[model samples]
Target: MRRRRGLTEEERELWSRVAASAQAMHPARPEMPAALTPPPREPVVAPKSLAKAFRVGEKARPRTGHDLAPPIGEGLAALPVVMDRKAHRNMVRGKLEPEAKLDLHGMTLAQAHPELIHFVLTAQDRGHRLILVITGKGKPGRDDDPVPQRMGVLRHQVPHWLRLPPLGAVVMQVTEAHLKHGGAGAYYIYLRRLR
Candidate 1:
């Protein structure tokens, strides 16, 4: 008979040992015990006042907390305007002569605020009708979202700031400048000449 090619004495002994050990080991099972279940998630609770503050479909009342009137000329009035980069260049290059101009580059919001107030007052004193304020195109920074306070901060805040005590008398209206100024980046401040 031909010799069979199979496990040698050492191999056969090792295989038997492994088989016996596996048989003695605990069998694998499908079910997990109840104690191993994950803990239940807690429900989120909102504040009572916030939950009841605004309901769906509720009509919002006009905010009366602060005065909404413009500083001068019976309140803010709409004016014809244009906002374009090319037009801004023409306006700045003196190719187009606006009534007046104020540049706010390299100025922080705090610095610009007081300066703007003073400039408007001076322009009004000088009897300048239309003044251009160049706040520059707002730059997006490292934050995930755009800066909450930007040139738009100036655009929106300037009107409100003007409505305050002293500056209000000089500023009749404030609107986005024509393309000749800086467009949305700039503003055309209309003033009432001091009597």
Candidate 2:
């Protein structure tokens, strides 16, 4: 390595003058007012947010503030586990085959809600312990609307409906399906046994 030398007084003076006379390549821009400026984003995920341990049929803790609604998998995990532990594990792993299934993909909210109630109620009446409800991961694509539309209405709403009046009384548990059973595109609805 070569020894470095400090700039002599004359050399420093020359550099200072040259720099002072030179123009900036880009003009300075005025700082944006705080009201108009976008706020700094929080970390998409933090190390601390991850679960310390992961197990089959484990509930998920929320991870980010940007989510309009938690993903179906996470939302289902947060719900209290009402089914048997062994059955729950087997079901989430796609081992326990659903006795029946309902597909709500391509239907609007108005059309889907009533159908879901009817399908779930009829399934319960038939003594089905578990049923699959396919909402199809919502349409994935570019959303250019200025009004801000949130897609996957059924994916988010179905879980709420399963836990609400009418159907809530019969629905025992709800969980995201495994890869063999349609992965994130479907749900496994566990219905309560008839008295």
Candidate 3:
């Protein structure tokens, strides 16, 4: 069995003095005061300059030029009246015949524009009343973006372009052909015969 050596009398007295000093130096901390609670926060208010800066009102004036016109007369002169889809349907539905068709299914906006203009002129020259243009419904190609060559590009743009000065005189009316002819992707162009 192992025996631990005992401290000398002087050493024991020194430890007792240290223990008393420690107890006196560090008395227990008192409970926190209730008055030390955080003060209530005040509501925020924006400065007058900032409030005035953010205020909005009606526009100064109405916009003018090509962009202001309806979709049918977008880049064209102001006609007496603009035809809506229903009115256009009535104008071209039974008037167009199958034999006068001009298929432009895969033609790009660039190719189609000039080709369409020329076709209208030629048709007018030949005294053809109804000419069908088949612009196929646009498909989302390689990048998932629409193929402008198909439906979206021409379907919306063609009517606007047809109403322009050069072709307006020759083109009596333009409307989406019936589903049997080609649906929304095709247009039945009715021409005013050359005088």
Candidate 4:
């Protein structure tokens, strides 16, 4: 919820000095036959020009793969506001409440898909302006389970599913629910006006 601040300049300087003078308490050298031992080589150092600058307590290095997507909150926040400004603020702030709600907590992907489609379409037809979709944060697999299992299967998929046709055509805005609702596990769906 809250981020810890990075080290101050004085703290950084102190750390650098401490690190420079520090020696390993116990050096480790594997015992190996002379023939098996590799010859030592000069330590390679990056050219000052090529060295990268970093601050203390920075986030981890960027992930190597391009396949990963941003966090749900970040991705959703980046989307342009597609609904009224006042309503949008109210919805995000938990000031506005949904008229109907659907829970897809226990359903698998195959089962949750159709159920979601029906719920969204029905809500639109009923002239409901806002609704809540609760896809509980996924559960982890049992230790003894033969195959590895992924958790929060529904939490991630539901948003993507809402953007597809049969539902996307009727949906206007989709945002994370407030604490009063299900928080991360739930979403507040604002439906477009029915024609």
Candidate 5:
């Protein structure tokens, strides 16, 4: 390496002047403007104001399938598990017939649990594509009852059970059964083929 040369007297003077000028221009900590100072309370944007600010353009794209919309009626018994459009269409049209079915209408959760597991496993072993499982819409409760009856326990619980481990692994889709197959009281469980 070559021997390094030190800065000239003029260069040293120039650097010192620049440093001094910079120090004079800025303080150690800047004094923020009152407008920029954080407020004690959390800031909130009004919904209407925010909506207007983000209002869609005149040429906005049409709503797609993913867009949120109100259900036609009271909505599905249980949200259908994920499936392609063609499979869903076929099932909805009642083209795919169930190979086996299990009705847990009058049975409690305990009674239904073992039956459901056994039925699904048996159907899967036999290579059944579609099967119906009826979980009756619970009885209507009196309007004047102090606490409303938790009707349709099976309707709600069955979907959750099908989504749990082992069951979820075998099940492809779980949709509300067609009117011919017990309507909202039942579900169509589409099972995956054995590997």
Candidate 6:
């Protein structure tokens, strides 16, 4: 696959303006496609070398908890994945500073998904264990309409992306960050160690 490129400053500015104007116009929402019956699951290919190198244990499995968001659309959110107590404590206390960061401020889901996959893979390869991903809390539409508003789209989508297929292998945990780290607009990604 051709490498996905980050949006330039100019493109970002243009997109922001376009999105704003489009929302202002209050265009009719598109009709939803019919949902098909669920297909058989395909087995995910895990990188054995990396898993061995990371020495991941049973603790790496995603556990059930209150932190999970309910299933939405085609994406299913992982069950409130979390790190060990020490790591979680450090993160909450702002002691475990992120080793890397990714800002997904102006990108749509189409644009952000591939970029997200690439970023996580690269971070894992580089031995980064902690990453902060900023997905801007999306703008809320005018409330006069009877339809429910779509707000903070990525806030719901990012977690789903982290739990799907190949990308899920490298991501050990996903948590909402403190206000200093962007609050509801971002996530802390804990990656499996690299060899």
Task: Write down the TM-score for model 3.
Answer: 0.49
The residue pairs that clash in candidate 6, if any, are: none
Off by over 4 Å in 6: 1-82
Candidate 6 lDDT by residue in tens digits, 20-65: 8774458677775667547779999986674444554755865222
Best prediction by lDDT: 4
Candidate 4 residue lDDT tens string, 1-195: 999999999999999999999999999877998998789999999767866788876977853322145668677888999999999999999999799999998898999999999999999889999999999877765645555544577988999999999888898998899989999899999999889
State how far residue 95 of model 2 sits from its true place (Å). Answer: 0.2
TM-score of each: 0.46, 0.62, 0.49, 0.61, 0.56, 0.57
Candidate 3: tens digits of C-alpha lDDT, residues 1-195: 899999999999999999887745677789768898678899899766744444355545542212223443232224332445464555445533644766676778898889888887887777786788777665633443343222255666777677896888777766666777777677777676577
Worst 10 residues of 4 by lDDT: 62-71
Cα distance off (Å), candidate 4, residue 44: 25
Runs in model 1 deviating more than 4 A are: 1-97, 145-152
**lDDT of each prediction vs. the true structure?**
0.63, 0.85, 0.65, 0.87, 0.79, 0.78
Q: Tell me the tens digit of each residue's lDDT in model 2 across 46-153.
A: 457565677865787643223465566886788788899899999998999889989998999999999999999999889999999999887644455444455576
Candidate 2 worst ten-residue window by lDDT: 61-70
lDDT of 3 at 94: 52
Report the C-alpha lDDT of model 5 over 1-195, residue by residue, as the tens digit.
999999999999999999887745555797899999987997777766444445558778853223133321134434654777798888877777889989897898899988899999999999898899999887754545565445577887887798897798999887787888887788888888899
TM-score of 2: 0.62
Give candidate 3's total backbone clashes: 0
- Model 4 residue 178 lDDT? 92
What overall lDDT, based on C-alpha atoms, would model 6 receive against the true structure? 0.78
Candidate 3 residues lying further than 4 Å off, grouped into runs, are 1-99, 141-151
lDDT of 1 by residue, 11-87 (tens): 99999999887763677786878899888889999766744567765797753233234422133334332335465
Model 3 lowest lDDT segment of ten: 64-73
